[model samples]
Target: MVRTPLTPEERRRGERLGALLREARGGRSMIEIAASAGISAETLRKIETGRAPTPAFFTVAALAGALGLSMDEILTRCAPEPDAVPLAG
Candidate 1:
């Protein structure tokens, strides 16, 4: 089945996710992390660069496990806060 294109908001969320992953990675090599996650370095690279915005669920789970991050923590960090209010000009 053909996948639908990602909306702008999804792209933005993906960018946020990528940033969080990068921060969590710290000084670790990408290859090492990818291997530990049971994924190819290229796949990890794409996700980290936001080239692969919507990764498979299992892939994300594996990455989270390898990085010592909880899915809840990842979601909390990547998702926008519902209580955030826009500043009035």
Candidate 2:
């Protein structure tokens, strides 16, 4: 199946999510965190680097649980910038 290209906004949101996860990781090793989240180190690395911008919901939940982050926090932090104008169709 073909995948749709991510929009600029989606890219930005992914970057934000990546940064947030990276920060939350603190000094923890990527491998350690990935294991705790029941994912591969490479998968965590991709998400952290914004290479895998849109991960599966379960993957995100697992990561959040491992990082002690609430989904609400993620949603809030990843929200569009206040100054960003809505995209017109």
Candidate 3:
């Protein structure tokens, strides 16, 4: 199946998600966190570095669970500002 390309805004949001995850990780080792999340360290690294932005939903759920982040928090932290104008169709 073909995948749609991410928009600039989506890319920015992904970067923000990466940053948030990194900050939440604190001093924990990547391997430890990755294991707890049931994912490989390389996959976590890719997400943290924004190299694999838009990971699968379950992967994100696992990461969020391991990191003690709520879905609401993720949405609040990663979403664009409320006042930002929407892109023209």
Best by TM-score: 2
Question: Candidate 2 at residue 16, lDDT?
Answer: 94
Better of 1 and 2 by TM-score: 2
**TM-score of model 2 vs. true structure:** 0.90
Worst 10 residues of 1 by lDDT: 76-85
lDDT of 2 by residue, 1-89 (tens): 99999998888888999999999999999999999999999999999899998889899999999999999999999888788688999
- Quote model 3's TM-score: 0.86
C-alpha-based local distance difference test score of model 3: 0.90
Error of 1 at 13 (Å): 1.0
* Cα lDDT of model 3 by residue, 21-50, tens digit: 999999999999999999999999999998
Leading candidate by lDDT: 2
TM-score of each: 0.86, 0.90, 0.86
Ranking by TM-score: 2, 1, 3
Would you list the clashing residue pairs of candidate 3?
A: none
Query: Could you tell me how far off, in angstroms, the CA of residue 46 lies in candidate 2 after the best superposition?
Result: 0.4
The runs of at least 3 residues in candidate 2 whose Cα sits more than 4 Å from the true structure, single-residue gaps closed, are 83-89
| Collision count of model 1 | 0
